[model samples]
Target: MYVTTPDEMRRIDNRAIEEFGIPGAVLMENAAIRTVNVIEEKYPALFDGGRVIILAGCGNNGGDGLAIGRHLMLKGAKVQAFLFFAEEKFTGNARLNLDIYKRLGGHIELVTHEEDIKTLKGSIYQADLIVDSIFGTGITRDIDSLIYKAVDMVNKSPVPVVAVDIPSGINGKDGRIMGIAIKAQHTVSFGYPKRGHILYPGREYTGRLHVVPISLPQDSSQAVGVKTFTLDDKEMAQNLMERPRQGHKGTFGKVGVIAGSLGMAGAACLTSMAALKGGSGLVTLGCPASLVPIFQSKMTEVMCYPLEDGQKGYLTLDAITGIRDFLKDKDVLAIGPGLGSKCDGLEIIRYILREFDISIIMDADALNHISRDKRLLSDYKGSIVITPHPGEMARLTGKSIQEIVASPIETATEFARDMGIIVLLKGAVSIVAHPEGNIYLNSSGNAGMGTGGSGDVLTGLIASMVAQGYSPYDAAVYGCYIHGRAGDYAREKWGETGMIAGNLLDELPLVFKDLFSLKG
Candidate 1:
């Protein structure tokens, strides 16, 4: 699903009004009508002799609230509107709606003073539902004025609140709460879901999201630079093709996973198992010689190769030639899960960066070693994917963890664009930034996925897809979605507290089966 910024949404709204010859008043009316429809359909008994209070501002959002009040009144419900601004302050479509509501003999009260706030509070205390249209996506600053007080009042009230466009005081572009934001039960977004609705903090405030189409042309949104998108199950299915009946093991592709040391053998096992479960036909785990025995005993289906190791049992630079020979027929190489942070291991990573020609997906220790010299990414020749959590990303980019977390999309996008590679910033909203400048935010996964070995599983999944002939970008997108979906399934079965990285592997078959069945 395409996500729009406030500015981009405005451009699309404008194009619909100016270029498409649709009137702004009509769009406002449609938005209000759809919002009311949602309330009625979702809660049929809400308007059965129940009083509703509409808290409106002087902007278009307020105009939508006024229209909703009028429609509710027409449906034999008691509706009262509290305009935060002076009655005369409303203009355009908003003013027209207010006039229409007044002409219908609807009750409208102007709230401008402290006494008015008290009366508004009394009215809200008696109302069954509240419609919050105080602020929309155009909100740019923190709410410190009277509106802040009103939002606090609404949040404190027990009545269910339905927000118009976006919850009041949320920065729609980035999902940050502007000092204070309304805790809304439902948000009626016009045309498409805003970035705030899917992003954190703002998502927490928005209880349930309902996107109501106000007739904005999709092509207009695309034309106006709406590049960010969230994936759904259907699109994910379309991205993956059905398996061929005549396909052999080599037809799927061979994955060379260089991971694990002496004590971190579990990391190697998880990654190799994840690759197999991720639909790779052949998986070869190249680990230190001492660790090979453990992997051989633990993993039944995964093939193994013993590479040269240092005294500490970590893969050394000498292992690079052996790994290169091992990867001769491999379609993709997944490096760096549990590969210790030793200098020799770093040397092996550097060797792969300089000489490896196959597509590479680096995670964990590989990312740690590369962060020591990020210049390798800028000069690398082959397709590369780097999956880094916040701390690792900070080290790689030489930025503070605070800076990267504050603006993850910008950080990932800029890195991907400049480095000409794919950067997967893994966290709450896993962001995949492509070299071509398109950004995708993953919509699946839950807090349960924060367990150890999750990143290894993700790296294996993404690398498996790449080996199966997917572009680095598509592989990252699909792999992230499936990995998250598997996590979701695991969470559903075992709850968040019991979910582990291995649980993701257990659910992979069910996820792939359900998704691949869509091809029929």
Candidate 2:
């Protein structure tokens, strides 16, 4: 499903009104009616002679609250509305809704002075529910003044609150919280879900979200060029590769993984094993000569090649010849899981990028080396996908981790567009950005998936998908979704605290089973 920013939403709304000739008041009425439907479905008891308090501003969002008041009144609820602005402040659709509500014998109170706060408190204390419409997606400044006091009081009250469009005081573009925001029990979004409704801190304050159609034309968003989307199960299921009734081992694909050093042999083991478990036909692990015995002891399904190393247990320039030979028949190469940060290791990475003309997945120390010399990627010979966490992204972009975390979508999209490569920015919500400006926000996974070797598993899984004929962009998108679903399965079995990276491997089969079942 498409995820829109505030600016995109406004363009869509304008196109619907000016191009399609839909009246603005009709749109406002549709929003209120759909929101009331959600309220009735979720809180049926609120209409049984219950009391509802509406906190309204002077904008269209406030008009939505006023319309909702009339609907609740007609449903036999005792409704009272508190307008933050005077009657003269309202205009356009807001003014029209106010007049209609007043004509229906609705009680309206103005909160223009400190003395009126006592009555506001009394009404809130006696009400069962509150509708928050003080601000909308257009707000960008920090919330203050009497509005701040009103929001604070509403938050303190025990009444269950439902928000209109979006929670007040949230920046709709990046999900940044203003000075304060209303904490709603449920939020009814018009048309589609906004970026704030899906991203972090803003998502927490938004509570349960419901996106109901507000009578916008079907092609409004497409006409406005919405390019961001949320990764969903149905789309992923439709894109999954089908297994033929008579397919052999060679039909799947081969994956070559060059990873591991002295103390981090487990990284190599986990990567190769995850590739095999992800349905690769042949999995090869290329490591230093000294680590072969360790990898052999840990894994039996994967074939291993011990590359010549100038240094005993680490990769060096000497391994380049053997790596070239190893990549001859491989479909995809996954590099740098446990590879160390030595100078020789950097030389080996440069040699591979300069010589190879195949798909590559770069992670861990490879990303660290590229951060030092990003020009190597600019001159590379093939498709490259980099999986970087916030810290690695900061190092690569020369920005603080806070900056990357604050605006993950923008950070990833800019890097992908500038670098001309796919970027999978791993985080609480993984964001996959294509060089062509398309962005996808992953919707699965849990905190339990935050263990050490989890990224190595993802590297292998994406490599497996790329080897099996999926495009680089689709591989990254599906790889993130599948990886998270596996982590979620592991969480169900061992809870978040006890789950480990190895548990995800055990649950990979189950994740695929569910996904493939959805195919037919």
Candidate 3:
């Protein structure tokens, strides 16, 4: 799955025409055919002498709808090609499609005036299906007048609506609504899924997303700097090899998790369990010696190593010697869950970055410390991954939280490129930015994942992946997707208010199992 910008999609389309020598009409025809096929397959009743009302505009999306209407009419399905744009405005292949539909005795009407929109209300509501092809990726401004009323009617109408490419009134680049958007029951997007269909209110409006491959060549898309990415599950499933049988604990990987304090022993326990669930064969918890009994009692499976106790049972610089000793046998490290920002805890993090030679994943207060000391940004001997909420990212980059949240894509890419680390800026739209300038946006998870210990769980998951021989970038992106997906699963069963970190932890096994099995 890739999140493509409207500009990128248009660029891809043009590249297909120019570089690949594929005609634009051919792509449009293929898209229209696929759209009609999906509609007929999804709703067999639509072909039973029921009429389809097409709300077409003067753009290419409208062209797709008009072509679909013509196809349906040719197939003996009652169809009405109700359009909003004046007939003179249809251009190129779109105008050609309008001519074909008219010759086939299709009903074509305009609703340029507000009164026209009001008059067609009953005809639209009476139709069995409404095709929302008014505006697609080309929509870039506020919607008003008849178009607004049309979007409103689609929302209130009893007829089902299928959107083309993207729902009308949604910005294809940003997920923001132009003014009003159609609530479509199905969206048959061609070539690839747009960014709007994956984010917020736009995603809510796009009911079921079905991707239809047009005549565009994938190689042409890459030539035009189409670097936008979508995290597809089946691709990730094929990434890592399954666990080797007849292998011992050390054969899998050893993950060292430096977490927990006096009052936050639960955080440490959560991270340890998540690491195990994330497929780390061996996990070691490094914490103040005071909480040894608590880890031993709460997490009997993990090997808890005692470190020097600093203020309030936090690890200080005195734990550096023991940390180095622990790291000698560890494959990956995750720090900053319950570790309070004592001087020792801060120094411990700095020491690990400067001296350690394994993969490191940071979260919570660790990112906070890195944000304060700008000098520590370049002090990494091994691959580094940082999972941060907007506030943490803001602190790390010396930017306001609003600034970080406003354009997360730019923020994460900027920080990761500058610091030479992979940054997973977490939220509804989790971004994975690598030093190589690749950014992956995650579309998993629900509102239930906003609870506590979620970040720790993500940290553990990433560390587990790194320990299991995954690159830092892959580990971070895959971990964010799985962690969020597990949260989504928990939410489906427990509901938002009922969901807890423990529920996500409980669903991790099921999520992993289902994702891997789906590869078949």
Whose TM-score is greatest here? 1
Q: Cα lDDT of model 2 overall?
A: 0.90
Candidates sorted by lDDT, best first = 2, 1, 3
| TM-score per candidate, chains pooled | 0.97, 0.95, 0.96
- The alpha-carbon lDDT assigned to residue 108 of candidate 2 equals 96
Which lDDT tens digits does candidate 2 get at residues 51-121?
A: 99989999999999999999999998899999999999999999999999999999999998988888999
What is the C-alpha lDDT profile of model 3 across 137-208, one tens digit per residue? 778899998888888887987888899999999888867789999989999999888878887668888999
lDDT of each: 0.89, 0.90, 0.84
- Better model by lDDT, 1 or 2? 2
* Candidate 3 deviant stretches above 4 angstroms: none
Screening candidate 3 with a backbone cut-off below 3 angstroms (N, C-alpha, C), the clashing residue pairs are: 1-230, 2-229, 2-230, 316-344
Local error of candidate 1 at residue 302 (angstroms): 0.8
* lDDT over C-alpha atoms for residue 305 of model 3: 95
